[model samples]
Target: AQTVTQSQPEMSVQEAETVTLSCTYDTSESDYYLFWYKQPPSRQMILVIRQEAYKQQNATENRFSVNFQKAAKSFSLKISDSQLGDAAMYFCAYVGVGQFYFGTGTSLTVIP
Candidate 1:
């Protein structure tokens, strides 16, 4: 069984500032995928970033990026110059073999 852990229950960042959210997972399988999903108050889950276990390069999109440390089983999300619209609940997910796991979730609040 695999489990995703998010130590930070909630995070806050000012507009135009950067914030990093930490995530760690436990898995026995070597082949797997990690993802960061954001859910606004509306309840829609949006894929923010993804990292393949076999890839060395971290994935990045626009102001979103991930720090994937395979050996440490750590995957952190970095939001750059965040906006008020970025406030939402972030989830760290892990998919390995036949199982899928999601963290409890971290709520991010962007203050203007």
Candidate 2:
């Protein structure tokens, strides 16, 4: 069984600032993939970043990065230089053993 958890339901960051969204998972599978997805008002799920369980290095895409701790079952997303456009519902996901799990999601608000 695999499950993803996002402790923070809502977060706010000032424009041009940075914010980190926390995630944790419970899984017995040794090989898996973790991902962060952003869904704006349009309700489209956009892949923000991903981390492979076999990789020790965290994954980063543009101003987005992840801190993936396999041992601790932790995968967190950091958004740097946040813009108003970045405001959205962020979801943490896990794919393993042919199963997909998603967190409840964190709503990010960008303050001008």
Candidate 3:
């Protein structure tokens, strides 16, 4: 079984600043995929970044980057230059053996 955990239920960052959301997962599968998704009030899930377990390098998409520690099963997201639009509910997800698991989520607020 695989599960994702996000310790912080809510986070706040100043506009144009940076914020990091923490996530950890437990999985027995050797090969899998980890992802961070952002969902706004519209309830649309947007892919922020993804990382392959076999890959040693972390994944990055524009201002969104991940610090993936495969050995420790930690996949945290770093959001740089935060903007108003970045305020949303962030979910950490794990996909292994056709099974998908998502964290409870972390609500992010961008303060101007």
Candidate 4:
């Protein structure tokens, strides 16, 4: 069994600044995938970034990037030039075989 854990229940970032959200997971399997998903007030899940266990380079997309430490089982999300639209609930997830697990979620608030 695998589980994702998010230590931060809530986070706040200023507009145009940068913020990092932490996530950690426990799993026995060596092969799997990690992902960060954002859910806005509208309640739609958006994939922020994904990292494969076998990949050494972290995944990045525009203003979003992930710090994936496979050895420590840590995956963090960094948001650059934070915008008001970035405010949402962020989840850390793990997928392997036929199972998927998600963290409780961290609510992010962006201050302009």
Candidate 5:
């Protein structure tokens, strides 16, 4: 069974600073996908970033980036120039079996 684990229960970032959320997983399959989802107070799951297993280089989208270590089964998300809008619950997930398995989730609070 493939499972995602997020060790950090909570994280905080200063507005205009950067924050990194850590995640690791155990999987038997060689090819799979990882994703970061942001759920704000509105309770909508938004895709912050993603990394495909075949890619060696990390993925980046504006202020979001991922440190994907396939060997270690680790995928982390870095949020730069944080804003109050960035405050939300972040989840690391594995996509397979036509669905997603999510981590416990990390609550990020942006201090201004």
Candidate 6:
């Protein structure tokens, strides 16, 4: 069985600042995918970024980047130049055969 772990229950960042969310996982499957999804108050799932297990380079999307340590079974999300709109619940998820397994979630607060 595979599972995603998010150690931070909540995180806050000032406007235009940066914040990193820590995550770890345990999985026996070698080939899989990791994702970070953001759900605003509206409850819409938004794909923040993704990293492939075989890819050595970290995945990045504009202000978002991931530090994927395959051996350690860890994938962390870094949000740079965050804004007030970034306030949402960030979840670390794993995708396999059918559905995705999400973490408990981390409530991100953007301080203006």
Q: How many clashing pairs in candidate 5?
A: 0
lDDT of 4 by residue, 14-75 (tens): 99999999999999999999999999999999988999999989999999999999989999
Q: What is the TM-score of each predicted model, taking all chains together?
A: 0.97, 0.98, 0.98, 0.98, 0.97, 0.97
Give me the runs in candidate 6 sitting further than 4 Å from their true place: none
How many residue pairs clash in each candidate at the backbone level?
Answer: 0, 0, 0, 0, 0, 0
State candidate 1's TM-score.
0.97
TM-score of 5: 0.97
- How close is each model in CA RMSD to the real structure? 0.7, 0.6, 0.6, 0.6, 0.7, 0.8
Whole-model lDDT, candidate 3? 0.94
Cα lDDT over the full model 2: 0.95
**Residue pairs clashing, model 6:** none
User: Residue 63 in model 4: shift from native, Å?
Assistant: 0.5
lDDT of 2 by residue, 1-112 (tens): 6789999999999999999999999988888999999999999999999899999999999999999998999999999999999999999999987777999999999999
Q: What tens digits encode model 3's per-residue C-alpha lDDT throughout 1-112?
A: 6789999999999999999999999988899999899999999999888999999988889999999998899999999999999999999999987777999999999999
lDDT of 1 by residue, 1-112 (tens): 7889999999999999999999999988889999999999999999998999999999999999999999999999999999999999999999987667999999999999
**lDDT to native, each model:** 0.96, 0.95, 0.94, 0.95, 0.95, 0.94
Model 4: weakest 10-residue lDDT segment is 92-101
Backbone clash pairs for candidate 4 read none
Between prediction 1 and prediction 5, the one with superior lDDT is 1
What is the Cα-based TM-score of model 4?
A: 0.98
Please list the residue runs of candidate 5 whose C-alpha ends up more than 4 Å from where it truly belongs after superposition.
none
